[model samples]
Target: MNTFKYRQKYKSNYFEGWYIRLIGKKNIAVIFGITTNKDNPHAFIQYTDSRISKYYSFSLNEVETTNNSVEIGENKLTKNILILNVLDIKLNIKFLNVKALKKNFINNSIMSFLYYLPLECYQEVIYLDGEYTHESDKGRIYIEKTYGKKFPKEWIWIQSNSLPLTLASAKMPLLFNKFGFYCLFEYEKKQYIFASYKLGKIKIMRSGNTVNINIKQGRYRLELHLKLNNTVRLLGPTNNGLMTITVNESLDSNLSVKFTKKNKLIHQSTHKDIGAEVEMKNHS
Candidate 1:
């Protein structure tokens, strides 16, 4: 089985989830997931329309999965298409002109550590960029994919199809020590990775709701700036039960990202309506 596939060997205290984001024209953004949280497993659908947000949850048994597809009741999710039907919303979307992030030795090697670690959570970007069309809703936008073996207790995730960037940084428990700040940034078709196992350097500065990350690898440097806007509370998994975690996410936030190689600028861009999440204890 592929290392990135959903694992079926989880323990009673473990959880696994898939995060699928679909952005459409006419100011529509849908973020939903299928979660198996041992204690309270379920499938959830959330979306925003005209600045109004709504959420729906269904039983875990309502979800089924193949190797690369997921079926939650009447909703289906795959790498190629998404057919969702919940409440008053119905969508039949197809992903076209897909552009996935290339998996190489370096990026693939970064995840090798998980094979030896006894950690409770992990994550990866399954799909980076793709054009999508919603037939029923008459909407069109970009789509992306993210799945994980439970979310980290403290982490910050940011992504933007407009900027064509994906960044995730986290601090979690690893064995007897803390995982420290490990980050992965993909931009301009290149991956700038900084992890504890790789012995790279990462510095973070946070003030109020804004976060700035500076990372240095062998001969590459990445700088990311993110600011939070109004957020909503979403259901997340804990060790014993499901908890309502406040995800400070804004599809309207601003992001500035720059990548340099050998002290020379390689790429830089500023994006709006970026997707961001800051989930830390007592912070969001």
Candidate 2:
């Protein structure tokens, strides 16, 4: 199922969230989501402008979604349209030239492994790239959905349509003192995955506001250099509810990437104004 339809499933410690990002000309951006955590489920909309940043939250009961559409209070999100009406902010946008990532063996294998884990979190990319129009201006947009019992203790997520890449690497809790380190990279239209089920290696280092990642799987290797700035706090999900954890995200960031096959450089590029999240600190 490419779309999320989990309203029927009921659990004490379950959580689900969808992340949507819209970029307009001159890098004007909006990021928002609807989250359902057992503790304090809610829907939120957030945006930052040159003068100030604003966030709005709504009760969980006001949120509803199907395979193709999402309604959060007065906000509506679908494959081709997004309408937001919160406080003094109002937005009506349309998406064009939509391109979605297709399911592949890599993603399927990762899902299979997560399904068997005790602390499971499933992730899927609903849309890879699309043209978003706000009034007379247009920019790019990317969307993703995630669900799980709880988030990993530590993880890093970075995505950029300008770079046309997505990377998620995490360390998840498991049974028998076994921990899972999973990394999935979508670059140059190819999926390079590293998980517990594969013979691969991943190294991550964080220095200040920058993160460097190196991943090797068979003959393929990828190096990602990410820098974060203008970060803001975003509500995150937990077993108890939305207040159990804090997520720090930045829409103004930079990403430099390199890919190699058999020791030969395949592609290299750098992109700016990326969407990134780093949740490594623990909060009780």
Candidate 3:
């Protein structure tokens, strides 16, 4: 028997429970495998506004585990992948050998995947890199939904057909947020989708001089090649899915971004139609 406990919080929804983790250390199976629609021993969830907890929910990939204590091939087994049936949906997952448990369940119990969570399945994730030095400046970014304790780093981004801007530590001047404000630049009416992290990977498809952002979710991985191809499509786990985009760009390289999940076809960079001035103004 194992135990797992944790708390989950959302702006609109509420969830925090001591779930059960089941591992079959009692069995003598050589290799335990599984399939699932959620992550191993855990599930990813999102919340919606103006709704109850059940109404605003979604899930992503899942994991399963076994208790053979040996390295086995990733395949299905003749056992029930899930030990607990508390979550709304049921998915398949496998295990190797039962280890520790979590949430009143097994801790770090290895499992296999039968399916993945019902993500929007964007087929794309773009990674952005930068630092956030100011409070007000950071608040201006609509990413507060994903914000955490720190200054809020590790950006996930998306963009339009226009040119994309890359911000380096050297390119973006250190900013102050409390009292002062500053102007971001736009070199040629381009757009910028970005996030930041200590390190991660990026995959993209480039056509001619311009580059297409297929996935932009985390830092760069030096050991692995970051490119989108038929053989290697899934870019792996990101910090989160929230992404940002700068609708306006020019040579000055200042960042004016509106956090839209989808890229809008028309950009209002003009004084009237574009509302460049009003766009810059963010009120509490």
Greater-TM-score candidate between 1 and 3: 1
Per-candidate alpha-carbon RMSD to the true structure: 3.5, 3.7, 20.9
Per model, state how many residue pairs clash: 0, 2, 79
lDDT of each: 0.63, 0.68, 0.20
lDDT of 1: 0.63
- Top candidate on TM-score is 2
Distance from true location, Cα of 258 in model 2, Å: 1.0
Per-residue lDDT tens digits of candidate 2, residues 66-176? 877778788887777888787887889898986666556544333544554545566666676778888888888877777766666677888888756666766755534
Residue 18 in candidate 2, Cα distance off native in Å: 1.4
How would you encode candidate 1's per-residue C-alpha lDDT over 1-284 as one tens digit per residue?
24334555454445455565565555555655655566566667767643666778888778777777777789877777878788788878887776554555545433545644656556555555567776555333444333445556777777777755666667766634343554555554565556656666766677777888787878978888887776655555555335355555566678888888898998888877677777653331
Q: How close is candidate 1 to the true structure, as a TM-score?
A: 0.82
lDDT of 2 at 19: 68
Q: For residues 1-284, write the lDDT of model 3, one tens digit per residue.
A: 11121111222122221111111211010112111212222223221111111211223123332331111122222222322222452223333322221221222211101012221111111111112212122100011011111112222222111222222110111222221111112224432222222121233333422222222333311111111111101111222322221212111111233322344322323110110111122222
TM per candidate comes to: 0.82, 0.84, 0.19
Candidate 3 clash total?
79
Order the candidates by TM-score, highest first — what do you get? Answer: 2, 1, 3
